[model samples]
Target: MNEQEKLLNARDRFIDSMAKNMSLYGITHSVGRLYGLLYFNEKPMTLDEMKDELGMSKTSMSTAVRQLQELNMVEKVWKKGERKDLYQAADDWYDSFTALFTTSWRTGISLNMSTINRSLKELHNLRDNPETPDEVRASVKLDIEKYQYALDYYDWLNRFVDSLESKEIFNYIPKKE
Candidate 1:
């Protein structure tokens, strides 16, 4: 194959690799592929352009663009007097990265706290039961202490994240006394 053809092949494989990696994180492969194409292209593309370039169905392209939009990974640009919405990757890819990070962390924190609370409540009930054996109650009390420690750790993590200034985090350097 000619040098140009080899380069194009390599580029396509890289884009596909990105899609696969994104899919591993539970994002749709098509959305990642679309983002790859937009990130590489010099100019914003309309849906038809993207479909033609990716050789995917127009419906797939439409859905991928919408999904990327929802993820804050892409934006619609207006062309003067043009009715079709032109799609472009976000100006700073970090915007997309931060959005994904914050959303996932928020959900994880909530779910973890909920589960810990439920476990602690059940353990508390087990310990408080009048007919419970002494040994069983002691075991339940130990489990409750472990759960409380876990909840305390999670709360510390939540506070740390909440105190961060998202935009400035990357450039921040700690002051030395």
Candidate 2:
């Protein structure tokens, strides 16, 4: 193959790989493919342009773009004198990773911590109640301990998320130059 053809082939392979691998983040392969296209494009593309290039429906293109935006993977851009909205992929992998992971992790941690707090509250009450059976009180105390440990872990996870968002994690694990 000619040099141009070889380069195109490599691009196709990487784009396809991106489409498949993005499933790890729960994105549909089609949407992942759309991200890959935007990442490889030289300039921001309009929704109509993306629809034509990907042979996707206008609705699908819109949904894909919205999903990428939510994940901080793609952003809309303003083009001078342009009527349609333009979007381009976020090029900084570190920022993208930080946004994606911190957002999801914080959400999950918040939910779990809330649940653990409620459960611990009830367990503590049960354990402290004089009327409670000795056996049940022991069980409640053990459950409280378990929940407290989980809460501690979630607290640590929150700190980890903070480090990632603040780029302080790089102090311990430096990025490649």
Candidate 3:
């Protein structure tokens, strides 16, 4: 194959791979297409341009752009004297991933903690009830303690992530025993 043909094949492969990977994360096909186009483009693209290039409906392009913005994977730009908005992928791809992962982790931890706390409260009420079985109350108390410990561990993890120094965090490697 000629050099130009080889390059085109490589580009096609890259976009296909991106679409597959993004699909695993629950991104729609149109969203994946938008990402592939933006990632491969030489410059930031406006919504209309993205719609035209991807041959996607305006609504699909808007949803994809909104999702990308929420994940902090894309940034909006405005040229001087222009009313149209442009979007470009984040400069630091790893930072974008980190932001998404951190946000998701924290949200999950928060939800789990809330559930644990509610369970503990219910256990306390059961213990206070005269009709409750002693063995059942004892078992629930143990479970509550376990849940509390887990909640504490999650809190520590959040602190650790927040306290991370950028250089150290990225370069961190666990020591061998």
Best by lDDT, which number?
A: 2
Ranking by lDDT: 2, 1, 3
CA deviation > 4 Å runs, candidate 3? 1-29, 80-83, 164-168, 171-177
Q: Cα lDDT of all candidates, in order?
A: 0.80, 0.89, 0.77
The residue pairs in collision within model 3 are none
- The lDDT, on a scale of 0 to 1, for candidate 2 is 0.89
lDDT of 1: 0.80
| lDDT per residue (tens digit) for residues 15-80 in model 2 | 889878777666788998898889989999999999999999999999999988988899999988
Model 3: per-residue Cα lDDT over 53-136, one tens digit each: 888888888889999888777889778876788998877666666665566667777888889889878988987888999898
> Each prediction's TM-score against the native?
0.80, 0.83, 0.75
lDDT of 1 by residue, 46-99 (tens): 999999887999999998888788778889998898888899999766668656
- Candidate 1 ranges beyond 4 A from true positions: 55-57, 160-165, 171-177
Selected candidate, larger TM-score, 1 vs 2 = 2
RMSD of each: 3.8, 2.6, 4.4
